[model samples]
Target: MKITDMTSECIGKCLNYLSFDDLLRAAISNKKLNNAANLIYEQKYRSKRVEMHILSRLHSNYFMTENRFCFYSLRTSFQFLFCFGRQVNEIHISYIPRYVIPGENGVQNENNVELTHRAIDYANDYCAESLRTIKFTRIQDASRYMKRPFINLENLEFYDCNFTDLVEYNLLNALFPKVQKLVLKTINKNLDQPCTLKFIEGRFAHLKSLHIESNSYSKFHHADEYCILKGNLVTAFRLNPQLKELDLDLFVNCHVFQSNDVLLVINYLQNLDSLSLAIDDTFCSLLDSSVPPLMYFRNLKKFSLNMQLSTESRAIQFTSHQLDTFELHGVDRFTNYEYEFLEKHPTITKLILRGGHFERLNLSRIAAALPILEQLMIFDHFKLKIEEIVPHWSKFQSLKLLCFFHTKIVKDSDLKPLLINGWHGRFCNSPNKFQIILKR
Candidate 1:
């Protein structure tokens, strides 16, 4: 039999036993073996091309044949990747100036402004042929570059990129007019105000997920000016009517706490299936609020909130029917009012609490509130009164995967009783149903 045929038969029979490295080693014996290996590893050809590119940088002496290396130069790895997928489903492209420096030797940078048209043509060709999800980040001028319409592209993401003005946003409305998922993350929040509003009206009319984050890594001269425009997430959501999930992180400035803009966001996204927020300390209204009457994401399952500034208290009231996983971080204290709100929810299956230093928490009351919580994580340093928490161990009957790390309570003998009671013969008895880990 031919070497390719023999290799294919062997792979079919012994794929579980032979690793990719083993196959490569076997194929390096002769020309017949090389051909057989190429056929077997064709799906990973781009990765192999990138490996050769990195090797060329590290060791100038190394070289590969045309078949081993992609047709484009090392600078156009993404370009080569674009051509490889015959049925393109998703295309995510991002540019960071540092990563796209001109080649030192004789190679040209394919990502330069002059060559971007060629890249767009490549993208257009693929999208025209098949359904595509196109996501771009750090494109210097997206509104001008992405002027043409795409027929088969369904989802679009623009992150930390530059755009000219509302005129450029008109171009986005023209392109991908049927986008079902829209995400925009930008540094110059003012530059694309109209573009953002237009997107909610044009493309995101039926958006399934809408995510927006501020590129606040850069310092601004007037720190407070961008707070209203940048931090007002409610304004962004109000523009969209059919959004199912929203993940927003906005700066908390003096004007953000109970602003009308925030009310607009809460009103629009009240029915989201998943929500994630990282906000500043100025917004204390986050602690206590009933679920919006118009919004009941009967399917809303995951929620995470990371408070950037230390707040005296925090609380959240939510329905337990669809909530299975929850995570809360960076709050100093959970007030009695907050605890009482959580006490009402008895069906959360997984929970995580991190960076908490409060010592006055009522452990028994907290445990009694959550009847179905299975996985619990109290990570990174948490100081608690062991005596107060240890006695309430029996309340958690369905408990599993308790991760309490970097805490003074880990060394206490009082915790041993709860540990033994919660985990003793339970894993074998429950069979991967329960586990507790203590890290200091």
Candidate 2:
């Protein structure tokens, strides 16, 4: 069959898998393909308004908006949105700086406070009221501006934001009153400063998730500073009692990341369904073997704990009965207690171990404990006795993917247990249901 003669359903499916650039080229190839593309893309943004970034880049996954059509090159690919049927959305102001616009119409320049404001104005005057999310990147300080709220924005994210941008902007409950999720991230490796959380502008009582991942080498470790930061977090969590996930731990060595104190404070959030905490030896010191460290989170489902730098033999217990995923980093002899914990929760399907030296632990023991585990990832770890898993091969029929990243096996034959299993497949060398992937 000729490619152009295919039905729009098949053409739409084909376009769906194409890369953004390729999809554009295909959409412009012929009339039928363009119609199929319009039908497919329109369904995606039917209820939700089109995503228009006031700034430079929009992720490839985002649907093209009329604002994006301002760039001349894509004028052809996204021409479907400009068809005579839909009324064109107007650009907020006629006088935007030449540097802020992308492509030939504008010159690429540094993002500053003024440019950020222009982007805000674009959104404030945006004809579409369903614009639900906004991301501010490399913005220094937008605390001052037209001071209008994005009435419908539900998720607000700031990447490499100014140190006090959120604090100064204060997430004014009025500006983003309906925001359910707020994310703050800093890839600035050299941000060696201290900032407080206590002085944030407004108490957003309706938040469902708050993720802050700043790896700054914080200088606020004094006793008074610690007390204040801890109290501030507790109060924030209290207000956002519906918070489901709080992922403040990304960089293990970030001094600003309050480990021991955060571990103690987060216990008050009982409804948390997912949690990630990157702690060190100090947090381990607070763990009591008799009582699980995470006893308070009754509804917890997915939990990740990175022990970063701990050499001593410590035992930490988890009490979440609904846990579906567990990731542990910097494992030592203490992981024996983790195995004990998983033994009680056989429903866990994913287990990830990273940058750890397992002296007395066995891979098969983990499989033996959690028989239903489907995905197992081990990254940057010492050599493992994967051959030892042969005894528990029967228990792992439910397993699907086993990945070893930068972690070497003892020898070539060590993989025989996972591969070439006769019970799950026809041949010993070729298994059908499971896979063993090795990464360097």
Q: What lDDT would each prediction earn against the true structure?
A: 0.53, 0.57
The residue-by-residue lDDT of candidate 1 on 5-50, one tens digit each, is 6665564344334555454465455555544454555544433322
Model 2 lDDT, full chain set: 0.57
- The 10-residue segment of model 2 with minimum total lDDT is 88-97
Q: Estimate each model's TM-score.
A: 0.64, 0.66
Clashing pairs in 2: 420-428
Listing every candidate in turn, what is its Cα RMSD in Å to the true structure after a full C-alpha superposition? 8.7, 9.4
Query: Which 10 successive residues of model 1 have the least lDDT summed?
Result: 50-59
Cα lDDT, model 1, residue 431: 33
Identify the leading candidate in terms of lDDT: 2
lDDT of each residue in 83-164, candidate 2, tens digit only: 3113222221111223434344554543234444554454454322445666665554543443566666678776665646
